[model samples]
Target: MTQSRPPLNAPHSTAQSAPGALPGTPLRSPADVLGTGVAFPIGVNPRGQLSMVSGERAVTQAILSLLMTARGQRVMRPEYGCRIHELVFAPGDATTLGLASYYVDEALRAWEPRIEVEQVQAQLDGQDTSRIVVDIRYRLKGNPEPRSLVFPFYRSL
Candidate 1:
C-alpha cells in the first residue's frame, strides 16, 4: 500500500508519537532501523557519491516534509561550503510535492552545491519491494565535471 508520510506540521508531532517518532520521524521499517543506523552513511563518500548514509529515512522524509511545508523559499547559499544548506530540507505538509521538486531545482545549492540537473532517469529495482532509484545527471557550474547521483526510496509496508 502507498502510505503517505506524516505531516511535518501536525497537531501530533512525530516526535511525540512513538519511538522513532519521539526521537525522530518515522522513515523506515523497524527491522531496518538498526542496519540503517549502523550501516548507512549519510554524507559524501570517498567516491564523491551523495550517500544517504544514516538517517536516510528521516532525511528523505524531512525533505518531503520541507517541500510540503515551505513555500517557494529555497535554501540558497551564494557562499560555497555553507553548512546552512543542511537546513534546506525540513518537514512540512504531507500533500505538497513542492519540496521534492525543490530538491531537484536546488540540487546545486546543496552543501557544496555545484551541479545542475540536465536529465533525470527514475527506475525501480528489487521487484518485491516498493523501492525507487532516481539517477540524475548534472553539470557542475564552474567546471566540466559531470556528476550523477542515485537516491533510493523505500516506502513503508
Candidate 2:
C-alpha cells in the first residue's frame, strides 16, 4: 500500500480546528495542556514522594517560578527569566511599580504558553514601603474564568 503526502505548496492542515472550536485554539487534553510537575520549593509529600502539582496549580507554580528566577542566573539559559530583578534596587515609586508591571507582562508573554495575561499591576505594599506587590491577572487559554496571583517582591531580597 502507498501512502500519500500533501503537496509542499498545500496550506497547513494544522490551521484547521476541531468542530465547534474557537479560532487560534487547538484541542488538547487537560493533562497535555495544563501540565504536571514537581511541586515548587521541592518538598516531599506524606507518602515520602516528591510533591507534585497539576492543572491550574501547576500552571500557577510555573508562573511563580518564572517570576522568581533572575535572568542570567541559569548559566545555560541566560534569558530564561523575568527582568523584574532589575528593579530590585530601584526606588519603590510609581515609576518603579510601572516598570515592574511591564516586566511581569513581558516575561509571561514571552515564556509561558498556558495562559493569556490580562493585566500585570504592581503596587507598593501597604505596610512595607520596600515591598512591591505584583498582581498578575490571567486566564488559561480555552478557559474563560479569570485568575490572579499576588507575588510580593521585597527590595531586601
lDDT of 2 at 20: 77
Residue 154 C-alpha lDDT in model 2: 85
**C-alpha TM-scores of all predictions:** 0.32, 0.79
Where is model 2 poorest over a 10-residue stretch in terms of lDDT? 9-18
Candidate 2, 1-157: lDDT as tens digits: 9999978666564666557766535666677779999999899999999999988889999999999999998999999899989987899788899899999999999999999999999999999998999999999998999999999988766
User: Highest lDDT: which candidate?
Assistant: 2
